[model samples]
Target chain A: MKTTLIFLVIFCTSIANAQTLEVGLRVQKTQEMYWENGVSAQFSFAKFKPEQFFLGLDYVTSRLGTAYQSNAIKQDSYLLSGSWLFNKNKPYHIVTRFNMGYFYSDLEEDMFAAIPNTSFLVSPEVGLKYNFKKMPISLNLGVGFYIITAKEGYSPGTLQPLYYHLDLYYSILKTRKK
Target chain B: MKKISFLFIYILVTISFSCSGPTITDDLLDGEVVFDPSLYNPEQFLVSAKYPIPTPADLNKHIILAVHGYTATTFEWQEFQDWSVTPSYRISQVLLGGHGRDYNAFKNSTWEDWRSSITSEYEKLIALGYTRISLVGSSTGGTLLLELVNSGYFNNHLHPKNIFLVDPIVVPSNKLQTLVGIIGPMIVYVETDQTAAENNYWYRFRPYETINELNNVMSIVRKGLENGMTLPSGTYLKVFHSLHDPVASTTSSVLIYKGLKTSSGSKIEVQLIYSDIHVFTRLNLRTKVTLLQKNNQLDVFNQIANKLN
Candidate 1:
């Protein structure tokens, strides 16, 4: 309840200041050779500034699937991140993001003598958003380095894995009347 | 750049080494035990035994006590029965309490009922004059066996000779039980398709309240450990797990292996089977074949039989 309230407060504050909201779905595949594929939906609130900069808050919920032996590995994650657009006007926008999140996997039940648990992932990402000149659509390509930490189990230590994502979105609601 | 290049090289080498490591052959045996559905037909796909025997014999020579996961039944062990000959040991397919019977019976039973049932089976085997026992348990059963040993139930001069654990539920924390207790039983459908049946026989687990019972089972296991009893001396413990099994992760095996005490007199071996399935039902065939060829299982039985002789 406390966490939800804090989140709601931040969301309300962000919406009041930003006045612009964007929501879209994203497909991501981990660049780590041993990892699997993932998909997520992201909701962002941002405000464009006079200095050609943009600041936003993003919440993403994602699912990842992997194959192990004869079984399928699935995980669900929720991430909250802050994004800063280095340049907003160019056809390609460069954005930097920092994220903190929790991930739950069904496999945790098997840990012997340990508590069933969840993992925390902290990541910093850099990406490019290429806007289609004529259409209100854009292609986003990004890479993030995540410090994966497991809680309450025999984790294989903190692994820094490379994650890559691509998203294509068509604006359903424009921030401006034009 | 130099450090980065070295790290890349190190990773490549590690991958290569793992791939080239001794191919853990499932080839522990040759030939197959074809399943004749007619020979051992299940009376009802799901029904309780009308005539419950107070003491079931070691009906087969190569006996394996097969225990299922939560809300599971004896039928889950049927897949394994087909892969072997009428061997030297009788396989005891135990239907845990609150399962394999009327579903309503579960609501009235506690986790203690399940524990008592397993202990009774163990005592029955001992009374039958079978000196050697091997346990093949999965998920919840795995935890139960570990607890059984820690509790000193098997600590006497004679006890189970070996244990085979598949995805034992050993966790570092207890919070998941609460969450699972809240939501685990909402699922009611059981997969009846052939493939689904083959893969997941115990599809319908007990409700969330039962999850609390499972938590009780865990507590008993933990208490046994604290009491200073260890897995029986010279007993062999082998664990097999898949990397991607969503129901039971590979980490479970790792944790159990870590907690298990290995005195010089005891032999414990842990093998993490790399597979993509929740349960390695397919490996059942390989296990039977391996036992048949090496006759390792026979040798164990023969040692017992010789004493009888």
Candidate 2:
């Protein structure tokens, strides 16, 4: 179990090569649940997969989307992910990624303090990314299933397992003049 | 070719098992029970049925329609009826349509069909000149009540005086519950592990079709909540949820608080019970009852009874 955890940590997170920083927006929807929209940021290091590998952080919440002057629960998710591109130098690439994060849904009242409103988030995702060659912009479409860490009723009800996201990223720097 | 044949045979056998139904001797509600007792004699279970003609005094008494969850019959709220020994209010246990019966009848029923039982009973009381009427629903029963409010069902009818929800399910705790369509064909139906006494009250076998209906109503209510819903003028709603309900998530109550508003645009009251049982108000026929559980049940019961009086 420890080895699996370590392997997952290594496979899904920070390892470096070529340097390019991308910051953007994420539009997310949980299956049959809430619409959570937020921001995303990614960066990669110097040699070994170059721009093909990226480590990212994302923060999404219903407050900005479905809960905006609406009745949806106010919840937030913070995720750290490692994504690997299937193609080396292409305008379009398939992306396989893994993420680990935390989730919380504010019950707003003190009476429900004991109810499980927090959970550790773990998910594996697969998607497609499209890069605009002339402009340093990219559009990504991804779907992910959260690996539920607790018993069914022990997790926050609004934190459903299946979700899809579409992200738009703008490259702030070149592939580090490789 | 031999391996392919073996795989095909295996798949066929699995499918056969999936579609298999219980035998007559299974001693399960799916095969053993003809129908819920309330269906056979609603007059004995529903106040509206028993007192079709109000005595003017009967019309003044508050009528609380008690609705049970998915697969549950009028038996779920039997304890409340037995406990309420006062004339200030009455209990009408309306069995949802298509429940407490054989598997086929259950498989053929829709959520709308299930909710009709509640509507028909409510309409009957209204037609009988019972002006003081309230509603109490548990689990999916609670969901249906909220749906009624969300869909504006009370617009044409008399407004309910008070609505009490116990462990309503807006979002299911079982994450795979969302994927029933994909897995339903292979699974056909689900059999719960319950005692014999429970079998006489709740459906032992849950058909995929009914599960789909459950999902459909939940989806409708959730979307409506997203858009926001309000109670009728002079109506009051309060949701009581178990802190760690195994069947329905506690977040359901949170949604109820956020989405449903009282007549004056104020947030509805929501209380998280200290127990873990899905419907803490129903302790009858349970295998083991804890003191705390009993206290929780009595607490809600007394609270409801007090409000009625």
Interface C-alpha root-mean-square deviation, candidates in order = 13.5, 1.2
Q: Residues A74-118, candidate 1: write the lDDT tens digits.
A: 344456676667666688888787777665544433432232335
Top candidate, metric TM-score = 2
lDDT tens digits, residue span B1-309, model 1: 999999788777655643431211122110022221211443222111211332334323334577776666565556554434443555566656665443345546787676666666666655555566677777777887787776676756365666777666654222234244323333321222233333233323244456667766765554343333357666767766544454554555544554466545352566554443444543332323443333433333343334222
DockQ of each: 0.04, 0.60
Candidate 1, residue B206: how far the Cα is off, in Å: 3.3
Q: In CAPRI terms, where does candidate 1 land?
A: incorrect
Candidate 1 stretches greater than 4 Å from native: A1-178, B1-62, B172-178, B181-205, B219-229, B263-267, B282-309
Candidate 2, residues B75-129, lDDT tens digits: the string is: 8899999999997998999989888877888889999999999999999899898
The CAPRI-style docking tier of model 2 reads: medium
Q: Give per-residue lDDT, candidate 1, residue A43.
A: 39
Error of 2 at A66 (Å): 0.8
Q: Mind giving the per-residue lDDT tens digits that candidate 2 earns over A16-130?
A: 3337778899999987788999998887776646678888888899999888888788988888899999886889999999999888888887877888998989999999999
